[model samples]
Target: MPPAQNTAGPGREVLTSDDIDRALRRIAHEILEANKGPEHLVLLGIPTRGAHLARRLADALERVEGTEVPVGSLDVTMYRDDLRSQPTRAVEPTVVPPGGVDDKVVVLVDDVLYSGRTVRAALDALSDLGRPRAVRLAVLVDRGHRELPVRADYVGKNLPTSTAERVMVRLAEHDGEGTEGVRIAGPAEVAP
Candidate 1:
């Protein structure tokens, strides 16, 4: 593929514009191909960054295949197993529209897939919503170190990293539309 033209805007970026654009393009193709070109596709993105990525994916898919896909955001903090045990209380209020997930192909999108806990919580959240015909996972970055057996159906980038590295997905939606894009770095840089 030819080099991507990112055209990063104003804000500071965690990753370069070209890198994120390339990843999204690749992921868009993967998603369309995986599901037979975006028929009956519903993208449910985990809260925060995942929601941002999902929106980007939706736009990318629309541009790539001329399909307007439904996209929504989900908050799984309450569904998470470790929320109560953690030092800080997590945010909640998982929202799924009344559209009904029954008999539809639901694709869970996230910024980064790491320990798999988020995906686990997401699965739980989906259960409360409705039973879909099929459920698949799509992640922008899969930094290996999974404590659970979860895996992504479509991965944009499989960045092999040790336990100490943190994959940060900085999108314009969250970080104010900027020139820089999503990035992965050391844990020391992460506030958590």
Candidate 2:
């Protein structure tokens, strides 16, 4: 593949810490409202950053509903369609709450919704588990350009970008990048 063109100058901040917090708060409320309470609701993070976002959302839900939300991590490494072409990646642990996905409202959480490939792989991984009454998607940033027909049920922000640009989500918990925010950066050039 040819090198991707950078759309944004270097790295441009799209969301700050406060913005992220507010977005999560709104998403938490929306999740609660849609589910008609937190009963049988499961927040499954899609490894790495998604796991952190899930925990944050769970905390927000707990604060509002005064009920503990089941937060876990889902690793879709084996289920990824491009696994054969990519380098070997360390598989993260898939931790489902004591109550499996069966009959529960499973909310797949992720940091960014880019090509929708990750979400597709997540669905494939989830099928191996139990069947959920319903499956919803929650994403902090929805950068349009989906290769699959997947959409986020709860979105914090809708950021439109070109195929050459990349969205980078930096969280204090995972990134340790001294700031919690979202940035749009130009793609890195590969040497010929």
Candidate 3:
């Protein structure tokens, strides 16, 4: 997939920075509560924006529980089923934290949950790492159109959208030099 752009004159903003902050905070709290504190919890964010979100969540969790949570990045490029159809792309570094994922609660973070294909690829990539006690998913936006039997354990927003529409999440950490927000672009406006 192509990189998400911060261009103008296309999608209308659906979420503001404050909204994203609130969502992250809520998600962080939910994660902490669900795990009964951050003990043995490892967060792995799927690149490129997921990694940024993961770091943010880790920071929030640290402030709440007064304990540092391990955060890592998992790149699912090679693991994607559409890789054969799409052009070859660079494989990003898969950074596992100091302690491996063995017997820990692994939460996969991502910007948006659409077709569930990315999450599927992420699961495949994760299997090579180590077995976790449990695996959960957390997404900033859940635009329901699942192709697989996957669901997010924690979601920031449940956006109902047509398959033709595109959900774009912009994070300052990733999009660089822009206001962070979520936008939905129509098929005609989005570049091919």
TM-score for all models, in order of appearance: 0.84, 0.91, 0.93
TM-score of 3: 0.93
| Candidate 1 segments exceeding 4 Å error | 1-15, 87-93, 187-192
Show model 2 residue runs off by greater than 4 Å.
1-10, 188-192
TM-score-wise, the better of 1 and 3 is 3
Query: Lowest summed-lDDT stretch of 10 residues in model 1?
Result: 6-15
Quick one: how many clashes does candidate 1 have?
A: 3
Q: Rate the local accuracy (lDDT) of all candidates.
A: 0.80, 0.92, 0.92
Residue-wise C-alpha lDDT for candidate 3, range 1-192, written one tens digit per residue: 999785543688888889988899999999999989999999999999999999999998998889999999999999999998885677889999989999999999999999999999999999999999999999999999999999999999999999999998888887775658998998997877
- CA displacement after TM-score superposition, residue 179 of candidate 1 (Å): 6.0
Sort by lDDT, best first: what order?
Answer: 2, 3, 1
lDDT of 2 by residue, 9-103 (tens): 24788998899999999999999999999999999999899999999999999999999999999999999988989958779999999889999
In TM-score terms, candidate 1 sits at: 0.84
Q: Residues 25-64, candidate 1, lDDT per residue (tens digit)?
A: 8888988887888877888889788887888888999999
Of the candidates shown, which would achieve the greatest TM-score relative to the real structure? 3
